[model samples]
Target: MGNVLGLESFYRRQLRQLLGIRHPRRISNAALYKRCNARPLRYRITKARWVLFGQVPRGSDRNPAFMQMARYFDSSTEGGW
Candidate 1:
């Protein structure tokens, strides 16, 4: 079989490594996004969840989770740019 791994494969592998999921399985990206967005953050800004993550609504780069995922996703593309 030709290589079946692609972006979603990479994403799943990385997420499993980062989230430490024991079982490798199929998942819906939309579901993951919705669930993350729904979880109550500690705070908010202008009635937005970005504040819960201490971000300034599309103006901040302080989310640790975001930073980590960025590293995992982009590090290979540009040698971390």
Candidate 2:
């Protein structure tokens, strides 16, 4: 069991070293216990609106044609005539 544990730790350290990653700091059990006992925060998303915020629509003639088709289909389904 000891040999297996040692080999596992050794391999983990070797993999980290090869990947240039630092070992994380060890946290004490008491600190973990305190964190578990802390109160949780209440969060809510308020006053939110969606906005188009990506690359501009390509200037292809097909783009507007597809959009117009979609809008027409939606209006017909919604009884807008």
Candidate 3:
């Protein structure tokens, strides 16, 4: 399973739990790489090899490989960086 910046893995954990980032021991890997404030795909997620965690957002035209299929129904899906 791989999509890189295009998001997969359950919508990248639902866009990193809508930015609060919760998973992998309730949140770890250096606290989701410092709450992803620097973004560079969260320091490339420990050099990605079938990721242990995920997220990718930096400006959005809603096409990060189809943007989670346009958020199913778009009842206010979420935000970004």
Candidate 4:
């Protein structure tokens, strides 16, 4: 959670700098995103994470990493790592 917040803060600061928006000319985050026609950084990160997670199950079953992941998800494993 701390990492996510740090990333978001960095993203916002960069965007503000890119658009030449300085302290005197304050803008709400929503307005800044609207000006750039972009989604929040968190949304993009979450979407990417979901996409990668979806691909993991589609990986070859013979892969040892996939087998271990399958075991981790199995009911008999009781959610243990």
List TM-scores for all candidates, in order. 0.26, 0.28, 0.17, 0.80
- Candidate that would win on lDDT: 4
What is the Cα-based lDDT of residue 35 in candidate 2? 43
The models' CA-based lDDT, in order, is 0.50, 0.43, 0.50, 0.86
Clashing pairs in 2: none
lDDT of 4 by residue, 50-81 (tens): 99788878999997868878888788756485
In Å, residue 63's CA in model 4 sits off its true spot by 4.2
Give the distance in Å from residue 75's predicted Cα in candidate 3 to where it truly belongs. 4.0
The numbered model that scores best in TM-score is 4
User: Which candidate, 1 or 2, would have the higher lDDT against the true structure?
Assistant: 1
Q: After superposition, how far is residue 74 of candidate 2 from its true place, in Å?
A: 84
| Superposed Cα deviation of residue 74, candidate 4 (Å) | 3.0
Global lDDT of model 2: 0.43
Instruction: Work out how many backbone clashes candidate 1 has.
Output: 0
Instruction: State residue 6's C-alpha deviation in candidate 2, in Å.
Output: 0.5
Worst 10 residues of 4 by lDDT: 72-81
Could you arrange the candidates by lDDT from highest to lowest? Answer: 4, 3, 1, 2
Worst ten-residue run, lDDT, model 2? 40-49
